[model samples]
Target: MSHPIHALYANLSARADRPALSDGDTVVTHGELIALVERAAADLAARGLGPRDRIGLCAANSWRHVVAYLAILRAGAVWTPLNPRNGPSLNGEFQRRAGLSLTLHDAASVGSLGSTARPLPLEAWLDGLADGVPPPIHDDPAAPFALKFTGGSTGVPKGVVQSQASGAAALASLSAFYDFTADDVNLAVAPLTHGSSHYILPVLAAGGAHVLLPTPDRAAILSELKSRVSVTFLPPTLIALLMAEADFAPADFPRLRHVTYSAAPMSPARIEQAIARFGPVLSTLYGQTEAPMTVTGLSPAEMTDPALRASVGRLFPGTPVAVLTASGVAGHGEGEVLVGGDLARTEYLDAPELTAASRHEGWLKTGDLGRLDKDGLLTLIGRSKDLIITGGYNVYPAEVEAALTAHPAVREACAFALPDEVWGERLEAAVAVDAPFADDAALKAFVRDAIGPVRTPKRLHLMPALPRNPVGKVVRGDVRDLLYPVDPQPLEALR
Candidate 1:
């Protein structure tokens, strides 16, 4: 059996003249990209990197970054992604944990790795084009392919070990579900190491072009949508910003086909506006680092229905999903979402105890709280750790945030708990608004009407924007810190 990379390379080889990848400053055709990958792979092998070796890639998004990624796989080494924006300390932490023997870095990030990584410039890998074909890769479905990490929002991020089978399944599922075509041009605005990279193989397999944008720029994205881009991924926060643009309109983007969102849930109200502004092209998928993005997907056709607006969509064709309740019963109703099958990762690197707890009876236990409808549509409630207990009533912050964002005035909202004398943990929220609205009382009333008083925020504050991590997830911890400050104050005194 040939490796998945071998199959992808074979596909690219046949489409020699077709455009494969490009940044604003560089471009490579299918044939040229494959040649670079082959040579780079040879170069890596010559340096003694091979199977079971963890190779770290720390760089910004670019054509070279893409080439290095494919080349690393071709060399039969495990690819470990280190986001440059994550800064030196976090990247160093991951490096120490993964025990990376070598790290490939861009010119910009070479200094950020400090002394922890055995850093080499990414350009050095591609320098020897005459390096010849890479050695044949051993076909092992269970072989570790990539090491991905969690967001570390709750605590320290764990390294999720992804097998070759899981990666192939993810690419296949995404490719089939999105229905990519040869004419498709995917605009990659998210980090290639994260969500954006999932679309790479699928698009390439279809002989489609990838337009790489190092950063998500609304103007450039709009420009691409008006012309060449057919498919792209945007987190909910970016989508909200795009919709807020004065000149943005659905009619301008006639060629745009799919605008997928994930990372964080979009408010149902915002989802409605997105559909209205971008047509039926809006889609979403729900998955974490362990399972990747193939677990469930909401197709463009499904977004048109108001009833399923809050749903992440039905499970992918071959994926297995179940909901486990608080009492540890797995069934068809509300509880913690569990996943099984080829797409799920089985372990965290070197952490047997943590890995053991993350699974139940052969299924990977997702820390997410969700409920599966009778038809298999999954509606996420929130993270199990994010559940806020106020007045002895369990209130998921996602529910409260959704309610707050549903009001027309709000653009983004974050719901969190504050220590309180009476309620144990009082629900408090902050929102970034589009247009100026009435005071906190009016917004609080709107949330109260939507989700009832028990879930409604006790105190609402308005900010220009909510703080988000590099990957665009709203940082709830930062919100609390901003509201209360460092020295700490009594809740009554702060209020």
Candidate 2:
């Protein structure tokens, strides 16, 4: 089978003059994109970088970044993305872990990369189209294609070893699930180093245009959706931000067909509000860094049902998914979510023990606690590690968060655990609100009524905003650290 990059090259060649990537002010045609990729690929080969060699890309989302990525693949080297939003120390650690030989970076990210990486200007890759093409390399399904690290929410990030087969499967699945067409234009609102990058291959393979927004600016995103965009991917946090924009409305997005959300679950209440604001374009998929976002999908049509809206969706066709309890698979109940398919990452690089522990029964243990209904629809409860046990009762943070977000005053909520002397672990929550809601006791009562006293958060605090990771996922750990500082608040203040 041909590599996904080779297939992408064929598609690019066929389209020629059709616009491939746009940065609002600039447009790169398919023909132009190929020429850039060919030149950059040839340059890499001349520099002695070849198959299996890791090349780091640290840059913001742009037409050039996309070209550089494609060129890295075309040259048969492994693509390793270093998110610009990450701290220098974190990126440095990732650089050392991945053992990247050379890093291609834009001006904005050059300072963030570690000194260990041989940083090259991304713009300088295409010195000129080479005299002859680089020597052809054989496609190997199991060869490393990309080196993406997991989001370090739980602990230290681990390098996920993604095979070429896994990357191809992700590309194919996204295209099949979304039904991308030539007319489809994908507005990349999220960072390309993250989830937004997954949509690029599918859109490109279908001969569609990719519009790059430098940042996830709500105003810029609104402008694009109002005009050229037909499809886009955003985290639920960002969707909430857009809704908060004074002018946000369904009528503004005439061309939008798919508004895909993932990274974190949006509360059912927020999802309903989104449906009203964005029309039926609100769709979502559930997957982690290990799986690369194609496990299961809920289409816009399926989202119309309020009950199904609570679910992440049914498993994607041909993808293996199960809910595993302590004993075995829970065919129609709640347990740890497991995935086994080509789309799942092969293993963690340089961490055999970690890899083995992460796998269960020949499947990748997703670390997500969820339920599989008789209908095959999966509803994620929370992360296994995030589950809080208070007074001998298990409390899913997501449940409490969902209830809090359902309140009109609350904009977004994050529930987490605090060590308690009485209860094994006490459930406490922080919320970002749209309106003044100083009555913490009343808010606690509201959540208690929604679920029950055991499941509801014992304490609720209003925050200006919740702590989020670079990709906009609310990090519960960070939220805890922020709320309870080293100095600690007085007991009276806590009450």
Candidate 3:
């Protein structure tokens, strides 16, 4: 079989001038996209970036950003797309750790990538795009394509090294599950630096158009969804925020075919509400940066059944997903989700100890606790790191958060455990809602009924909003830090 890049090149021959990428008034055709990539490849060569030399890209969502990514690949250099939101010091630190030779950045990141990356401003380089054709190199399927960084949702973000083979496998797995057509208009809501950016490749491969939304401007997203978007990916929080918008009528998104949501724990009740509004278009994806986004996906069709709608859906073809219990025994039921697959990363960049710790036997321990039913649909429990054990009872925060969000007013909820003198830890809930939770007592009662009294939060605090990483996964640690300030408040002042 031809490689994805080669296939993309082949597809360009048939639809040479078709819209490949666009941002506002600017639209680049497939022919233009290929020419830009080749020219940019020459620019990278002139700047001395080539095979085995790693580089970084720091830019927001733009067609130019996509061209830069493809150009890096075309030049046979490794590209790592870092979140441009990072400060210069932090970006420099990551660059040093990753040992990037160069970094291409837009105006927003040009200052942030100083000294560490032999920083190259994107505009200055684009102005000098070479007229000569790009020299071709043998395509190695096993060669590293891109180095992806995980959102520091847990802690310090780590870089995941992925090869072209794994990326192709991921694309193939998703294509089998989703239908991407030339007529589809893919909306780029997520930043190009993030994993969701990978969605653009399949669309391009399908001879479809990719529309970029640099920022998640709520109005712009709503307008795009209502008019042009056939496929788009939104994190759970963005989905919630858009749904909460006053003018957001589900019927407005008549053109939307697939709206994939993931990267965070979405409330089941909220998902059901979303499905009711947008029909079965809302898909829940379950994957980590380690897997590069295709472990399992809950399709709109499977979402029709209430029981299946709440699931993250079954594993990809030939992908082995096992839930290992505390004893490290794999089972079909509940435990840590261990996945052994081609898509999952086997090593962490510069962290051998961490890499060894994460993988068991041949399976990579996903750190996510989940269960698979007899039919193999996966239901996320909670992050094993965030699991709360209080009064000798195991409490998965996702369960409590789901219960709390089940309340009509609750928009988002996160539960954690605090140290206690008698009990090992006491359960605490921090909730974000449209309005203040009127009765903490009644809310606790609701949780108690849904889960047990042991899992109910002893203290419930209201937050205007919860902290989240760029990808929309709740930064549980940040929320915990905010909820419990230093020096501490008196017991009476709490809640």
Candidate 4:
């Protein structure tokens, strides 16, 4: 046992009889899970795969997904998890690009993968394998264990190469952040290809049970809450939906200790409503694919104060997070976020030039522009690329959005810039509203009074809902498109 999976495997024997996984109909015990992992690993090797070989898994959330991931790592293969909802063509293209040899897929996501890899139906593969011990693995700590895909909200997606040490550090940070224990029963709702999957592993590492939701239904999750689901994680959009749809008296969710939210910025108004409804169980974390589940957490306790709700959270105990300005000083109050720790990814799968430009001496430069307040809490301004230049002044979209979303009628907001001959660049705002405002003049006046005249957009585009990426972050480019049909740049001049 020379890997992190081995460390987890060594601990599973103590909790062998405990329930390790549940998928609505059946519960798999810790012993059964271990046996399945070992058997799957042996079977995979018998079928001509070897250590460090990449295996693609495209499936909905289920016990099978969890088991396959553990089995792949135990057998010393890289697990490339793909979104089952991405359809067969996109999934197939990604598999082809990754040069995968085999793929295990569930019935729901068994899309036409063309000929990239030999497709094995998930259950058929498991049932057909002969049960045996998992093969021995001697993987380097720095070798990649998983190829996590980026959200690709702005441009082409890239396969992020995450090393074993990074994954181990992620597990450690999650365990410390959540303060999870053997008694915890974690409920998962988001796609496993995203943050929800990583958040559940620490529960198993602590000998707790993980319940998978095939779909994140409002009714079903509320029902599950009635039972003893001690902890869970949902994105802010889902959190807002659940709050509006469910009945949350103080006693409604007593069984839940921590209901974590992330993958997007949450409104303070929504947080106020959630705190009143959920009784302070709501928490949030700031994470990226490079370093996930525990970059920073706005804890349940910290969330008790509404003033701190707007702040993302302070850094975890051992992570190295700094605000580096244009001057490159780590002590800057407002600038780009630089993450340096074993948890950060050093490179993309195949993009060396992009990787070289993105990293500063082994530190992952998170392109987020934000300020760390005197209290040491990191408050994100916006992505540096989203900065709006108007009348020779810098305006961050998040600040303007904060003002728009503060109005009772506004649900979400986005601000973008278009080239202007007079101002160099002009600001335009888009808003998704719950109710109609008086008029554009009234709305502009509201923003002008709330934020300032300098930050106000030259035009406002009101819509039913703002377009969002898969992980729930609002796409500012989409907002820009709503205002300007063609390119907003000046012909050969704006650049």
Specify the poorest-scoring 10-residue window by lDDT in model 3.
486-495
Write model 4 residue lDDT over 179-298, tens digit each, in one string: 777788998778887888776567887889888888889988887876778888887778778877867765877688888888777777877777788787888889788776677778
CA error at residue 391 for candidate 2, angstroms: 1.3
Q: Which pairs clash inside model 1? A: none
Model 3 alpha-carbon drift over 4 Å, by segment: 1-4, 111-115, 248-250, 326-331, 469-471, 487-495
So what's the TM-score on candidate 3? 0.93
lDDT of 2 by residue, 367-415 (tens): 9989888888998888887777788887888888878887877878988
lDDT of 3 by residue, 1-495 (tens): 423455457566777889999898999999999888888887778777787678899988888888888888778787788776766766777788788988888887766564563777787787677686676753667677778777887788887777776777778877677778788898987877876677767888888889998899988998888898888988777888887785555688888989888777566678787887776788867888887788888888777677776578888885778888767756488888988767764468878888899988878888988887777788887888876667777788888887898787788888877777666677888898777756689888888998888888999988788777544567766787786776243322322
Q: Against the true structure, candidate 4 has what lDDT?
A: 0.79
For each candidate in the order shown, give its overall lDDT on alpha carbons.
0.83, 0.83, 0.78, 0.79
Clashing pairs in 2: none
Per-model tally of clashing residue pairs: 0, 0, 0, 0
TM-score of each: 0.95, 0.94, 0.93, 0.94
| Model 3: how far residue 127 lies from native, Å | 2.6
Reference-based lDDT, residue 93, model 2: 89
lDDT of 3 at 49: 74
Per-prediction CA RMSD (Å): 2.7, 3.1, 3.3, 2.2
